[model samples]
Target: MNGLRVAVLSFAHEHAASYISLLHDRTDVELLTADPDFATAPADELRGRGFAARHGAAYVETYEEALAWGPDAVVICAENARHRDLVLAAAEVGAHVLCEKPLATRVEDAEAMVAACDAAGVVLMTAYPVRFSPEFATLRALVESGALGVVLGGTGTNNGKLPAGRSWFTDPELSGGGALADHVVHVADLLDALLGEEAVAVRAVTNRIVHGDDPRVRAETGGLVSITYAGGAEVTVDCSWSVPDGAPTWGGLTLQVVGTGGVVEIDPFGAHVGGVVAGGAEQAWLGLGENLDALMLEHFLGCVRTGSTPGPDGRAGLRSLRVVAAAQESVAAGGAVVRLTPSSAR
Candidate 1:
């Protein structure tokens, strides 16, 4: 059987590197990458033609050339605001897409991306690797099996160091609304999957106090988002870039679920070996668990091969984007509650 030809659209997001490295050696995938937008990216950043060469993947100079190569699938790791265009391009060429998270900076753009893929009859999977975590799957099972009855509310934290390496992360025009936009979608999508319901309202408070001294930090550095779901469950997310630079890892995600029966908490990054290096003073942790990104990629490839619909499809991406949009609006309104209509949720 012939392997699938996969093209990576851009390398703006850090995850693009990992995706390429993981897929490059797969016998079932022929890998190609393009990053025309990063032609002049800082040498310190892992992007442009050099990064692709390091991973032993074929590199192209432009999106047009990549799509023209006739790939079976495309992975979009462009900036938050650029997702719509890349997705539209892939859809036009009948290539399935796995778009990076937050989907888009605006609701209208996300909606348009979803609509275009649907019309083109191509699979549009949202790049939400967290959904593939075994820990989260266990939590969902407990909730569904009556082990945790009637989920009341929960708290989730997706804290990470400020992405200083990528200047675009702090630019609202390119990356959307800072921590709120960068972090909220993961937990929101998890909640949506667990409850199988839409968010009814959102209220949020954001501040620029964390990285405020940096002139380049135009977006909020920290935020707390309260989401009310249609199932009458509430989840509060701490979407903040609060992790200091000295941390052993980039960041971590932790969730605590409360229900009438009991409470359960999970730290996906908790299962790791921590120790000081022989010549270094700082401690480092080596993760000893499954790589969620690899699992997600396998799932995506499986869906493409079988012509099955992906879980957390384009609609799921739009749903999570809606939560982030509402959160941003709430922040703009000084923490006022922003309601979402049922029709809009659909």
Candidate 2:
């Protein structure tokens, strides 16, 4: 463990697969160990070992063992509810953390995670790969630079295929509230980064229309959330798992920002090199422009090495968590407008 030792906290999240591979390949990282405690399959466990061994690391069964390896930083791929504890533990060890999205199941937990990291004086960065996306960064610039010309409002959509294999994603205790929780934070944080504002109030509603009466579909798979900011600018987000399995691709997002000058529409995945197929019955979508995850990791590890606080940090995570918490409250209250007050403000 010489230059930038790293550890993976869990294999509970699907992202761990790609993230481990990337870390193993990085020449700058001296060690990369993955604690594969919750790996679902033997194959997955083997894969984690392979990813670790390639970087001269040994598999660790427990998080404590992984920490004992003396990592400079840790990547948390734990469940949403487990985020708070993992963050607290990692920060306690004086390791900077880069955690997955939807920070935690509750706003209080997200707040506590931020406080713990702050108390430890360790960087607490959230994994918001969309912020590093080139197309998204370009759109953010357009919005912030007044190129959009006095923005009126915006319409955002992130309709993606259901996480078919991941049952914990819909579990209320693990993933928070489902569609609204999973999808809201991406665009919410993106807009906050672009506009330097957070929503003051929100009204949201959900429907269990997908999955056809399967009780495993315990969470809402389709939903609409309306967020209003202090400046009266509003955004209606179609944050749902409404995409059918028949879709050729994994689904995508679209953002339309209207302003006095004109409307700026950004489809980060719209520019595809592929063409229509099967008499236009199905179109092959190839929206693989950039590896935003790699870029985000690069930034996080650089901060770990330099001891600099990173962007889209725990505060950003907390703000998005508050917005989702408000949305959930609105849903429970029959789509009533729930006022948003960030936990940090309190």
For candidate 2, the lDDT comes to 0.81
Q: What is the TM-score of each candidate against the true structure?
A: 0.97, 0.90
Model 1 — TM-score against the truth?
0.97
- Among these predictions, the greatest lDDT belongs to 1
lDDT of 2 at 213: 80
What is candidate 2's TM-score against the reference?
Answer: 0.90
Report the C-alpha displacement of residue 252, candidate 2, in angstroms: 1.2
- lDDT for each candidate structure: 0.91, 0.81
lDDT per residue as tens, model 2, 33-93: 5555456534423445655565455577678888877788999987787888889989888
Give candidate 1 regions above 4 Å deviation.
343-346
